[model samples]
Target: MNNTLTNGLGLLSLVANTGRAHGVTELANMAELPKSHVHRLLQSLVEARYLEKDHQSRYSISVGALRLGRELLRNIPVRRMALPEMMQLVGEVKAALSLAAPFGHEAISIAHITPDGNLRGSMESLGSVLSAHASASGKLFLAYLPEDEVGEVLAQLDYSGGGPNAHRNAESLKAELPQIRARGYSINNLESGANMNSFAVPIHNQDGKVFAALGASAQANELSLKRIAELAPILLESVQRIESTIKEENP
Candidate 1:
């Protein structure tokens, strides 16, 4: 790529990484570019709708960037192909179901289904992000990843508020991954939230590669580990269905 485009993207990355609005001077300093050059690039991004400038001259990523992200996600076949099976699984299990994928240092929920009931607690939204060390889906992703990669991802997490039962360090978490792999699933027992338990199984793609995680969550009293284990067959069945659908659609 040309320097102009490269520098423009560099500036954009600086702003995005900050996760907040930034002024021209601030961006220039962080990117080590001249203020005038940064201003020109920022204006170009604003005109392209990639970034938006406020009245105070601060800039932040705009809706267009989110639109681009959504467009990319829309091209992924798993979410679309898995929705029906996920919904059916939710009905069979009578709990909240979620489809999540490893995103950056965390797990991002792609789709969610909650059975119609009064027993529902706070459910994770479709786009919600969860700590990889605390949530069942996250743990499943971590379990399947290389240990070094897992350590890199875990290094980015803040464990202070993870929960009472959360793994305190990478060493402790590494010790438990074998059990997860042995069972071909992961469990969360009040690790993410109080009295909340979840179970997750890996969903594979056409190449028989783990692509995403399918999980079910409910109140701890309603779903114990044994109950989750019993439900595992149903969940794995749904995962197989989803995998088949993905292969059919993708191939």
Candidate 2:
């Protein structure tokens, strides 16, 4: 890890996540770095077109960054390739479906769909960030991470304000990861919201690493542990198709 490169990327991530402009001093304080060093990194980012400085001398993410993000979303093969299978699964299960990928310490839904007959109160929204310690999709993401990386994300997680069953700290969540991995899936039984239950299975890339998670959610009355067990084969079949598609395209 080159310190200079790491610091520059860290500053970029901070600006992008906050969605607000900040001055050099504020960013320095937030990142816990020297003011002059922060300023130099911010200037370098500006030159690289990742951040823009206004006349007020506050820095914000640039159009260049937006374009890059848009381009990456457009080119994400899984989101495009998984749609047909997702639709099929939705029709079979009549539950909302989501495709999420790991982003930093969270899982972000890149795509979502509601089943026919309009399942009321579906919680997943496009671009929504799921709490990594509470949501099935999020825990699945954490379960597949390298051990040290999981520790880093756990350290940064905010454990406040989840449902009654949500893990309150890193230790409890860490204890559950091995079981999630062993089973090759994860479940959230009212862990993120009232009456919400969900399960997720891993989607691997060509390298056989977890690339994203395929998940389904519904009200607890509608989605029980037994129902999830019955639906697991459907979810895993779609995952197989998605992973096979990725391998065909990338290989």
Candidate 3:
């Protein structure tokens, strides 16, 4: 192996985020790596489940990559502390409970509690890439990623259409993000769905940087917007408990 290999970790990261569905050649161009080298590197990354190669030879990152990151906090106390409270809240709110933690440029779901009594939110999978532009947890995590990553996410969010409910006004959402940063919550509607609403609040680290988002989703009918407002305090309180437990264990 060349000691100064051009095919390395940095190139892998580049391929993972260059808008998905890329072949090794295109990835190499973006990564400034050579074709043969990048192709072999991607094969290795794919074997390790850090990347996935489609039947068409297009490549993107795998959920297993996020799973590896999640394992770092396998003992995360917040998840345990929040689970029961999330369960209880889902019962009370008759909605779905969702948690998202930072996964590079995306917020990957670390935990979720679904209501069991014949009620469900649209989301059922544990590892789907919920839209940062349309999903509550996605938008919430978008605000907490790195500065440049946040800019990229926001720019992408711009194309989601200015409709009636979620992020109806681009200027307004931009103005609100600062407020969200100040207050520690991200709330919006994609406005694409007429009968759905979601609310998300950030879970802060001891350093006060947001590392996760606690979210609840429901039909606009079963859980009215006013009801969500009433439920915000309790949802936030659960988040506090979750964070406090994590800090106590780690710090």
Candidate 4:
């Protein structure tokens, strides 16, 4: 890769990671690139439809970029590959299953499956965003992040959006992350929503980094901490299967 291409890709990554629009000067300052160089790269990206320049001259990732992401996801096979294992886990646990990914400071459900019968908890729909501080899937993501990044994420959380059981401040939440890491999973005991309890374990990619969270949610009355602990092995087993499948497809 040439310097120009490298710099352009870096700038694009910076803008996409910010999850917000930015002006050229701001982007240049953030990227520590020359203003002129940044402007040229931005124009190139806009021309390629990888980014869009707004009326205010601010730039953001465009629909074309999203299309590229969707195309990549379509080929990745995680959703299709993981569905069988998810279904098996859901059947065994008799709870709602979810696959979620970190989206900035939030966790968004990418896929979900509810067990048959009336004993079901409220499940976040696909694309539904939830407080990372309160949800098991979100907390799992947070636990794996660098400490500084976790603090930054916690600073942005709306404690009230989490329920009364959630840690209300970063300090408290930070203290709990170690335990989650040690346990290799996270639990939301009526934290995200009343009577909704969930447990989540990380699904790793080929590099062993957390690629996503695989979780199960049920009514608190139906799933207790002891029960969650008992079912965790099953959840972890499914995660391993998903990870192995991802490795096979990606590698």
Candidate 5:
């Protein structure tokens, strides 16, 4: 192996594979790296396409590391074309809408739209994950995920209590899948927090594989089961627009 692979990232594969990025100090401690050596090694890896920096200066595997995935979606037909329509859906709801894409061990809010004046509260809390089980988008995400990955997250769940949907167990969620698929939307009620309701639907790519989930989140005052029912058709229409756009772009 080359020096960069061996001495730099190889010793730190455990941390890299952990999926959570680290800073110089935490990575050094985790990898038993000396303070002096950590910075240089991380710098080298960052330069060599093995690592990337977040806004907070934490390091994680870079997009360059996902070349195979890039190739898979190189012309990622759906995500590319769905932007305008997804934005329009959020506008129609006059609430915060977001799209969460599956990352290795987590999800990323790949798209979100907040108009100049929104009826619901702030959406800044998104783009970061709290619980993969509690949020509507998360449920849609986990529910449709590959079986093994679903097992991994469920296995690591802290069953003690109190999270997005702490009351639910894996089996309960599994049971809900068919309905979510049947209904074409995932609804989460008072699960993320008191007086909140979130709803989501999956976005399928050209090959008919689910690529992301589109969701809307709002305070209880903003969304009632009644309101969600009213909004459902519009949202599904939005999802259709996005899927069609993606295929058009990629093809």
Candidate 6:
């Protein structure tokens, strides 16, 4: 373990999370590090362009961090390949779209897009979690995991949240996996959020294993189950394009 790197990152995170600048002495007090040590670490970060020091001798996250973030987003093949198609889908369907992949027992959104002026079903809120048993994308991801892994992930899930239609336990949700697979999509009908109906389809890798889930969400009145059925072909076509793009770029 490189203690220097770890401590530097810890301090950088503390400053970045606060969304403001901090002087070395203030950061040292906050991080419980020696003032001189904090100054040295901050100087190193500034040299690396990860932090910028102003005339006030306070440091804040800099353009280098933004560069790294942009690079990270570009390098995520699924998110990169899916974004253009997601944008097109948003134009056609006029709904919010999200790309989610399974992470532990939850489905975390890697990308989110919403039509202009609507925030009801947008999944852009930081730190929002999709419960594995209830969300459309979560259920689609779970439906494709191996049997043993599914059981393990299900055991770790928290079924206490979600709407009145959500499954109360693993057994109930587990029983629905086969149907989700057979139908080629998953639906969250007031299960993850009240008055919101979200639908998702699996995005498979070159080897045909599900890699992520592409989802759409909107107020139930706007995206009724009937409308979802009408939109299925379009969504699947987008998935096909994304998968083809991935194979071409990565192959």
What tens digits encode model 5's per-residue C-alpha lDDT throughout 1-251? 77555767554574555778778788778777586888888777778777887889888887676653446444544445656676556657877777677765446665566643332222254345535666777667777777667666776664444345543676676677667777887888877786778788888888888878877778878888889889888888888878777778668
Native-to-model Cα distance after best TM-score fit, residue 141 in candidate 4, in Å = 0.4
Best of the candidates, TM-score: 1
- lDDT by residue for model 3 over 93-167, one digit each (tens)? 677777776665456666766766332223344544555555666666765666665555565554455235666
TM-score for candidate 5: 0.68
Tell me the spans in candidate 1 whose CA falls farther than 4 Å from its real position. 1-21, 25-38, 117-124, 147-158
**Angstrom error at residue 52, model 2:** 3.7
lDDT of each: 0.82, 0.89, 0.67, 0.84, 0.69, 0.85
What would the TM-score be for candidate 6 when compared with the true structure? Answer: 0.72
lDDT of 4: 0.84
Which ten residues in a row are the worst by lDDT in model 6? 117-126
Give a tens-digit lDDT track for model 4, residues 103-215.
Answer: 88778877778776232223227667767788998888899997668777778777767776998888888889999999999999989887899999998888888868888
Candidate 1 at residue 113, lDDT? 75
The reply for model 3, stretches above 4 Å from the true place, is 1-33, 46-77, 103-106, 117-124, 130-134, 138-157, 161-163, 168-170, 178-184, 190-194
Q: How would you encode candidate 1's per-residue C-alpha lDDT over 119-226 as one tens digit per residue?
A: 222223766787888889888888888766777776776776566688887777778888999998999988888888998999987877777998888998988988
Error of 2 at 135 (Å): 1.6
Q: How accurate is candidate 1 locally (lDDT)?
A: 0.82
lDDT of 3: 0.67
Model 6 clash tally?
A: 0
lDDT of 6 by residue, 1-251 (tens): 69998999999889877889988889999999999999999999999999999999999999787776567566878987887788778889888888888776778877878776232332244225688888998898888889888888888888999987999998999999999999999999999878889999999898889988888889989999999998877899999999999889768
Error of 4 at 236 (Å): 0.6
Candidate 3 TM-score versus the reference: 0.66
Model 6: CA > 4 A from native: 1-68, 117-123
TM-scores of the models, in the given order? 0.80, 0.76, 0.66, 0.68, 0.68, 0.72
- Which parts of model 2 have CA positions greater than 4 angstroms off? 47-49, 103-106, 114-129, 144-158, 178-183
TM-score of candidate 1 against the unseen true structure: 0.80
